[model samples]
Target chain A: MAEISFPLPDLGEGLIEATVLDWLVSPGDQVERNQPLVELETSKSALELPSPQAGKVIRIHGAPGETINVGEPLVVFEVPDNTAGIVGTVPKDDAPKRRVRLSAVLDED
Target chain B: MSESTTALLEAGARDEQSVKLSMQQALNRALDEILSTDPKTVVFGEDCGQLGGVFRITDGLQAKHGESRVFDTPLAESGILGMSVGLAMAGFHPIPEVQFDGFAYPAINQIVCQIARMNYRSRGTLPMPITLRVPSFGGIRAPEHHGESLEALFAHVPGLKVVSPSDPHDAYHLLKYAASRPDPVIFMEPKSRYWQKGDVDTSDAGPLTGARIVRPGRHLTLVAWGAMVARCLQVAELAAEDGIDVEVLDLRWLKPIDAEALATSVGKTRRAVVVHEAPLTSGLGAEVAQLITQSCFDTLKAPVERVTGFDVPYPSGDLEDEYIPNIDRILLGIQRVLEYRRG
Candidate 1:
């Protein structure tokens, strides 16, 4: 299982923190990308935060009414490892690679 | 001739000629002229240098002034604004574009805390003369976070001069004036009307800190700014046909509003209506209404009315025409105010 982490979005002209209004999704619930995850209030207006990944929410860092800062992790998701071969592994330089012909010719000629 | 007389003569000759140009083109010309005339003036923002900005307001400026003077910045709004504050403190006139009204949120902290306080914090020893140009308003059918009317937020902040231009002429002259001022300015350009052509007489352009009366009427005064000024003009024409004389006043400088013009118009008309594209609750109209009532209480024949957007996140593009105050709403507001007979 791969862990998906949610970061606080930049709000209010370089503002660092925003008060959490309410959470729409709870731990263990499945969420899709761009789905409303939480409601937040800034000095200017109230905003809804969207989920960044499609997965089950494993954990929430803060409760309702708590202020969250930008770039701070807000939620964790368990995503399926679809590209297991590429996950956390470096490509081997010695592996056989395919070569492509720059020009094509007719065999009859 | 004396120096003042010579200057006046030169200005008079310049004012007589009218030039027709779109709002964005006029803004580009103003930047070109200012950058050419002042060595200390600099323009920097996202995609502003080589790309000439998203709307091309800064087009051709990079080639004319070079990259050092007119250059593109990273996609960080906060960094752009904070850097402009430092440049201003160092005695350079920095005009940073926030790209859009919604994107300006990332620079609010730097603007409110740093740029706004630098002058007062330094006790006038260090002056921050940064001009932040933001293209604002709706009706362009842009995506989310593109069209927002947040002028009230900047106007509420101290040490910041918030100005919005209604047309090409105001856009050109106000930008030049903002560059010359010794304080941070939030210069809001009407995004939707950027291509609307208008006649601009570079000579007749006035100072940046005053208001202009666009239409003269005797019944009621309608105060507005930015693109709403143009809408108010249309409303005035319609009202005239309806037999209601309405005066349209454009508050060019939102922060240091023209109290003289406001007072005079309201005193004469005795009835007033404040209109804007922003929401009704706590918008700039609130402040304008308070000021009018406080200053022209005895002269007011009716309570000031406000026609503005609802207190909700700007709706989808399809509903924007209904969401924003339009000519019909203005006419309704005029009718409401005219019907108010003090018992």
Candidate 2:
């Protein structure tokens, strides 16, 4: 399982920080994508921070009434899928060398 | 797109509510609208519900539409298509998706014999209004059997209508049109172009079926579909550097190809080049060349040419660079057609 951290997104207008109003999801709760993870109060209004991805909630960075800076970790999620396996590969270092001269094709004319 | 996929419009209306979306998102929205509008329509395929497909084209659709409408099926491609045939027979519009272009092979019998000929065999009684969504073509460097261009195989079928959208707008519109058709449509979704973002006007659509002349030019016509349309557009740009005007045509429907569009663009330019990912031997390019020849032979400046994949089996991702026709190869084909002279 991979632990992914969701950073607090800048909710427009060059906002710097937001106070955590309430935690809608607990640390052990499994959440769906776009689910309400936490409700935070911004300078202008209070809004719910939705989970960016669906995963098991591993940890919460801020408690209620705490201020978390923009771009700071909001919550950590443990993703279940392990996709490391045999798939397509682009070997950047071993890119196939290719060269074509139009002279050879044009010679037919 | 540094060069956007432009549909050669005839007299289509444009909408004010255009969203910059990827082809996948456009398709998802189209499916959502299809499910919402048509209560008889059903969408099901392997891993399409929970995992939201390997490409995530069906993401959040299952939760939104519920299990009965947008559900997952068994891993069997044949079974999925067979079930689609049965569902269509029961007066339902079945929009079944095969994970990849290569995966459609297992369901060929059900697709060709049953789905293609159902209406004809029943004398227009039982119509198979099935839109088989296949993630097609190779550019993502996918492994063997993960990327295959099966357009020719499907297009050769008598009753099947094959379509591959070059951009998100067309992807959104053509899919909804295909789902609404009474006949079966092999909707080839260019897997590589899924993430290519473009402006999708969800309001109104242009022509339902026909090749779109994305770039209008006076010199020559570059005909292509699916992933190759974008590549041909890129090549057209490169060809422009050499002062060669190239008209890029997106052949939307492969079965009943826009012969008039081919005739119009090629008749105007008098030179044509067909590009495709399928193998050169008996590929759809051959048919396209013949069509251009038949239509624009009298006014043609040069013979029709084809730039395509090698005759060998579609290889794994490692050899894709060498297998699939690159921009240079297409440019070479264009050059060949440009320099052709009758001996």
Give the winner by DockQ: 2
TM-score of each: 0.73, 0.77
lDDT tens readout by residue for model 1, A2-108: 45456786775868888888989999999987899999887778999888657899888778889878868788877653311110121111222222111112121
Would you list the clashing residue pairs of candidate 1? A12-B105, A13-B105, A13-B106, A13-B107, A13-B108, A14-B106
After superposition on all C-alphas, the RMSD of every candidate to the true structure, in Å, is: 21.8, 11.2
Listed for every candidate in order, the interface RMSD values in angstroms are 31.6, 6.1
Each candidate's chain B TM-score?
Answer: 0.94, 0.95
Tens-digit lDDT string for candidate 1 (B45-152) = 998886567776887799789999999999999999989988887889998998888999988899999999988998998898888999887767666777689899
| DockQ scores of all models, one per candidate | 0.01, 0.11
Candidate 1 matches the true fold with a TM-score of 0.73
List where candidate 2 sits over 4 angstroms from the true fold.
A1-109, B1-15
* lDDT per residue as tens, model 2, B1-343: 2233343232233535678887877998899999999999999998787556776678778878889988889889999999999999999999999998889999999998899999999999999999999988887788778779998999899999999998999999999999999999999998878776799887768787788989998788999999888888878877776778889999988988889999999888888899999999989999999998998888887789889999999887768888889878987888787777768
